[model samples]
Target: MKRLILLLVSLPLLSSCSDQWGWYVVDPTTKTGLTNLKFLLSGLEQTVLMSFTAIAISMVVGLAVALPGMSSSKGWRRFNRVYVEVVRAVPILVLILWVYYGLPQLMGISIGVFGAGVLALALSDSAFQAEIFRAGIQSVNRGQYEAARTLSLNYVDTMRFVILPQAIKRILPALGNQFVYMLKMSSLVSVIGMQELTRKANELVVTEYRPLEIYTILVLEYLVLILAVSGVFRWFESRMQSDER
Candidate 1:
């Protein structure tokens, strides 16, 4: 965390060296640079909001999909396999386009840009989330289930009290990775005019005519966001381990 903070703090200072790199476009020392900085940062809120909403939706859908795979019924298991295989095969970009353009036509409904992006991201990510959830749940010891039954616990009680807690603990790291992945994937939505970080950068690039400088800033922005998320998860996993001990 300290390293991340230091890196962010020093980025602006590098521009002070010279304007040879056209870093002046984003140089916080100048008035135009300060203006451009605010413009670029303006999209941060939307990007974070969109990623969180999509991740929440995907979690619910993924758990629903995962539960069936663990069921005794062969039909449910088959449905789970089919759903995961099919969805994971489709490219997210294509899915986003279809949701934006194709779905409204097919369903006679109006799916706006934000809605389409959320749907596409959630659907695309749910497949991977289901696999992680399925693995986590299945990783629980078989004896745990028998022990729960020995305690007069029913299926639902057993899962709620005994199984899911352990499974969630085991899957925390995987879930964190998926969130970081979702954040990066959310940028693809900017292709459809969602005004996310990438979209804002592109718009600024056109007017400022400084793609090199603007995109350098864009990469740094994501690098900081993703690195911070990664650091937080590492801390969380360590905290969970300490609590277990």
Candidate 2:
């Protein structure tokens, strides 16, 4: 993985040696390039913040949705099905646009770009998260539920203490993947003027007139961010597996 990252990072530099490429715009050695680089990296904080906030919201909302679907009542199951189906069917870009532009009109309240982006991301991802949680919960051994009932635990207590812990462990990887997905999807919020990584790159491209060079760095930024996130997830998974032993 390190080798792959190094190779990817080096590709643009090698190509930039040609006269056609304007690598000077992002060259770390010069003052202007360093400033431009900093300007681009500035968006990193917003991107990470939005993605994390959205994913966290989606997890909670998804768990709530999943619980209803798990209920014995047909009405609740139908509600879950309708919600998941409708939400998952919508394109995330369209959802973001609607949340940013249209939702405020309906609610009669203003939402900032960051709030709109986060809300849209969370709502769009909640459907998938619901399925992941449901599968993970269902995968828990039936004997575990039986043991909770034998202990005279109520449904809430059984889920909170006995079921959720096991299900969360099973679902960690899926959650991690969703976080990664959220990171990528957050770029779409750029369309609504959320000043994220892609937005920074786009702005720089307009001023520098070097789309190729600027966008190459943008790609690298995402690549590095995603690789780092994946590494963290893998470390957590390993630690959890070791603890299970």
TM-score of each: 0.92, 0.95
RMSD of each: 2.0, 1.4
Top-lDDT structure, candidate number: 2
| Clashes within 3 Å, all models in order | 0, 0
The local distance difference test score of each candidate is: 0.90, 0.92
Measured by TM-score, the strongest candidate is 2
Badly placed stretches (over 4 Å) of model 1 are 1-20
Estimate the lDDT of model 2: 0.92
lDDT of 1 by residue, 105-192 (tens): 9999988898999999999999999999999999999999999989999988998899988898899999999999999999999999
lDDT per residue, candidate 2, 1-245, as tens digits? 87967877687677757777778898889999999999999999999999999999999999999999999999999999999999999999999999888999999988999999999999999999999999999999999999999999999999999999889888889989988988999999999999999999999999999998898889889988998999999998888887662
